[model samples]
Target: MKQQIKHQYAGQYSQLSTKDFNYIKDHLSWELLAAKKCAHYAQESQDPQLATLINQIGLMHQRHYNTLLQYVNPQSVQD
Candidate 1:
């Protein structure tokens, strides 16, 4: 009998495919770039308010990166 593929928002699966890994990799790359850019601009800004906003943006991106990273390696949660 042939198996079926089920799509879900959240669930545990026995395995992940190469395409899934590649998608995660691409998203991680984008998050990294966004974080770096926000940080760099935040440092370069002269206005205090703008700097604060940029810093917040950077933090958000960093959080996203961390979340994605955790998804990539669930074992790290124990560390």
Candidate 2:
């Protein structure tokens, strides 16, 4: 039989419902993908200012990704 993994979220409740968990997982993926896409476009950009702006946008997405990751697995998160 396949095993199921459980998650505990921070705040008032320790556990998330299946729907909420799935949403978080999906959101996490979206954030990571956005970050990667931004980075790729930034590298492909020839304009210095545009590249910088894209890089900054990528950083924002990356930060959101990481924060969501921490919530999903706080134990693995490093200081």
Candidate 3:
């Protein structure tokens, strides 16, 4: 029989190995770049509806970036 490892909630001081840190950093960079590009496209768009949709997409990416940052340094997030 195979055994499954249970997962637990990570705290502020939870250790992240170097490889995990590198992977998270790479993902954060991509998310930030995607958000920037989406925002730029939204600003350049002439159609109101399209601009609004793109802006929402940008906001989603921004939120993902912020969440990842908080995970990286949980102590820094106040709320």
lDDT top scorer:
2
Ranking by lDDT: 2, 3, 1
lDDT of 1 by residue, 1-79 (tens): 3343333323665445677767887998999999999999999999989999999999999888888877777555443
Give every collision pair in model 1: none
- Which lDDT tens digits does candidate 2 get at residues 1-79? 4334566656433566677778899999999999999999999999999999999999999999989998888776677
Listing every candidate in turn, what is its Cα RMSD in Å to the true structure after a full C-alpha superposition?
A: 4.8, 3.8, 6.1
Off by over 4 Å in 2: 1-13
Q: Which residue ranges in model 3 land beyond 4 Å of their true spot?
A: 1-12, 75-79
Which of the two, 1 or 3, has more TM-score? 3
Cα lDDT, all candidates: 0.79, 0.86, 0.80
RMSD in Å for candidate 2, one decimal?
Answer: 3.8
lDDT by residue (tens digit), candidate 3, 1-79: 3333222226324556676777888999999999999999999999999999999999999899888877876555566
Query: Model 2 scores what on Cα lDDT?
Result: 0.86
For TM-score, the strongest prediction is 2
**Cα RMSD for predicted model 1:** 4.8
